[model samples]
Target: MIFFLIFCVTSGFSTLLNQDTLDVIYRYVQKTPFKKIFERSGSEASFINEAIPTAYDSRAVYPNCKSLTSVLDQKKCGSCWAFATTGSAADALCINGIANVIPSPQRQICCDNKCLEIPLKQCDYGCNGGVLTAASLYIENNGIVSDECIPYEENSSKPCFTSCSKEGVKMEVYKGLYAKIPSIMKVSENEMKKGIMIGGSIAVAMNVFQSFTLYKGGVYNRTDGDFLGNHAVRLVGWNDTAEVPYWIMINSWGTEWGMNGTCYYLKGKNLGNIESQTVYFSTTPPTYHGRQVSVSFSLIFIFLLVSFTAVLYLLSYVCGRINEGEKKRDLQEKEARTQMLREIGERRYKRGLKNRSSSSVRRRRLSSSENEDEKDTSTRMIDDSEEEEESEKDIEKVGLLS
Candidate 1:
């Protein structure tokens, strides 16, 4: 059952997308006219202009930086704006020698309401769609947490969490400032390459076609399909020396799609408006000042220890009660058996006394019968004597008369 539930969740999360559904989602908002541009100083201008490479890739240049190489999935949600912003920020932090930590896109999706509250056309509206410049402003004003603190849920309705929910993870806020090249309009191809050379990786919005979704390999230049909505992606590097010049881009569609979640666009031509609205960040190392820990590990340990002790104490009390009940029952049973035996002995003694009284009555009746028989014998003898005496007298008288 657990495995089936996991499979269902995984399937729901990784559902593939088609062009017909992607067109209506409203994934990107164009830059607003009211937003200001960041004016670069002389040294910053010299740094960007000094780059001479005809072909460059941020992954090869910063091989040790995991942020540039790692690809993330947006997972059936239209929060590509969040992914592009957070991803580019992570790469910028690593390249600027600040810190290597992936900021949480979930925080922006749930917490930041700059675009929602303010009635601005260029601002973000959570997962419905967002502007890159507005998302960058959000990062600058209210910092975002690390992915370890609050992992991406790909959900727009999730409530904003004030503190980290993950156990044993320290909550840290990463703050940074952002800028867009030619802040008012779309950047040219040469300008986009220069920005890539200066910054490690940057965020850009482009029109997606149905054929672009089925891209497998090679430079994707097919403009044959119906126009899907605008999508946000990270612009990593470019190769101008190849037979067909192309720009390498990192997508938020997971590693299973395209060339390990990367796609190439035909360079020198603004196909799909690929060179438009480049946004990059300048970040600092994360600070551990705000809501560092929700519940300390020591507190958790103490709670568990107390709970275990209480359970043991409860079990001991219940067992003691059971033993006392058993002992009381055994004593009652022993007294009952003793009383039953005593009653049986008393009944036998009363029955023996009754038998002795019956024997005495029978003996008295026999004695009376013997006495009557002796009396009868004596009376008979006396009668016989009297008769004999009378006969003797009669004989004497008769002799005298003669």
Candidate 2:
């Protein structure tokens, strides 16, 4: 009875674990758009004539291009589309002689908002999720900025400035032009190998399983785990000579995952539909010497000349107005002074006339007073003389009478 009870408990736990794994697989399979996987373009014919190698690795071929060997981390954001696209483009640029530049995945994620405009299975919703083809098209047309221009932001809310944010780096200098991807095509396994050899690296999509996440090393061929969602990665090379025959892939899960952020998928079977779609780009190196620079310089020179002329004309006009105002003010001040001086002279003349009139009045009053005093004196003397005569006459009579 004890043994039977233990067997029952073990069976029950196994059933529960199986059920959980089925649930995870069901969710991933439901999320994948299976219809898009079958869509094919006939561009594989272009590479049919090229010789195919048994095993090739871009890192071994282009030893100087560090981007081909370096593994980037996408963090928690679902920005694998941006990283894969930009990584493949960077490898191509370095392989073509434009050296030492890793294109900005952040720029692609934030700035390329027109992914929805292009009719694709999925739209690029930044960190939420995105389509691979839409990202490739953006790099082809708009041309991506260098990683030095804008570093990757794990935050989904990062905004697009569309300009170089790094100090001492001009947007025009690092931001290149004429990034060309002849075509975005879905090809067979052999065709994908030829494409990688012809071009440096190719961006490819694959379905991820739960077991893929825990993968540490070895040629990964396990398809017996919980199916995760689709992921985008760079297909750098492949080895058909291996026991399982695997395609070399560079992942954006950081160097700690897999074999230093690299993995191997079963090549011929297209186990994760990696060969279903692929993209590559080629660009001409920018030249600072030649007609392009001359035209840019000419435009700049013309702009400076026009600006300088406008400033000079404005200064001259202002100076002329100021001089005219100063001259008018001086004339007005001079007129006021002349008027004031005239008024002062008039006041002085009026004051002089008033003083002369007062002097004449004083002289007349003095002369009239002197004349009256003289008249009084003369009258008193006359009266005294008359009295004296009368007294003398009386005295004479008295003496005669005595």
Candidate 3:
């Protein structure tokens, strides 16, 4: 059953990979004015560049507090909307150091049933896209929506649909299939280093090419490829200083995107704004959500009684087992330590014996594998050369006598 379901989902997602679909989507992006508008606005990127302080910061708040982990995919999928909304939520959580790892954009994209907000017509999965901020606003106003309620889906397959319903949220409108991700570009070593040092309101530039499909660790060369895919990253920190510096940037394409789990951007200049951006946060949470879940005091008392009893018994058993395990582990560790000491002592004694012995010179010359191989090769060559010399000398003496 699980395999069948997995197969169905995989097949559904694969449908988006149709060549005609891809060409159409690519054409749409190429023809779209959004990229061109953003290109002209050096100061304000259409999707990102407008900077602001993080949401949780009380001192100075900026509009468009986006998720540090959610990159601006623009018009990629309905998932972009989840990304936008979650980015806002994550900004609030991250700035406060409350939590990281923004909730899945997949969840919001597939699950939220509020159609009036998330129009059913425009967001069917194609190369076409939508906004995430609206959906996040809905979640904030309403309670948690379960994946069981929603299920994982491929937006590229069907037109975006409201699969689940909530009592608090209405069908008239849901968050769009995408949202704007305001970014602060860190283009240079100086600016990037400052963002890493300060660690706030920083967006790192990324090149999304075919090779960027699966990222491993290490510093990469931006000059190597065309940098076909453009995205923003969150600055984490700097690594090296000896030759050129490396900047640690967090990618929103899950932990799978770069540097094993991170990416290093070699320095460039004014690729985007490293300074001059601000962020914002909501002062009050949305009305339907944010309030604590209601539970009766009567139920609470009974729950407390049962929970305390269970916990007490569980702790006692765990403690008793732990104590027994510790006793055995301590004995084993002591035995292992003693064995190690004995081996060390034997090595020292052998060293002393070698030093006192006449054969110490031979031992000294072949201490390691590298020296041993060299010695063997050299010894054979010398022996062969000596035999050749003796044969030549004997022949010369014989010739002279003859």
Q: Write the per-residue lDDT of candidate 1 for residues 1-402, one digit (tens) a residue.
A: 644644454445324322211111111211332112212244445555575578999989998777788888988888999999888877777787766777788888887665322222455677887877677656655666778899888887877778886888878876654443344345876667766665688888888998988899999987768888999999889998999999899999999889999988888777888776777765321121112211222233345556776798799999999999999999889999998888888888777777777777777777767777767777767766766666667777778889
Per-residue lDDT over 132-242 for candidate 3, one digit per residue giving the tens place of the 0 to 100 score: 223433444442333333433445444444544334533332221111222222233443333322333343333455555544666554434355544434554454552
Native-structure RMSD, model 1: 21.9
RMSD of each: 21.9, 26.0, 34.3
TM-score rank, highest first?
Answer: 1, 2, 3
Superior by TM-score: candidate 1 or candidate 2: 1
TM-score of 1: 0.59
TM-score of 2: 0.56
Candidate 2: Cα lDDT at 277: 68
| C-alpha lDDT score of every prediction, in listed order | 0.69, 0.69, 0.42
TM-score of 3: 0.32
Off by over 4 Å in 3: 1-88, 94-101, 107-152, 156-206, 210-215, 232-234, 237-243, 252-257, 268-402
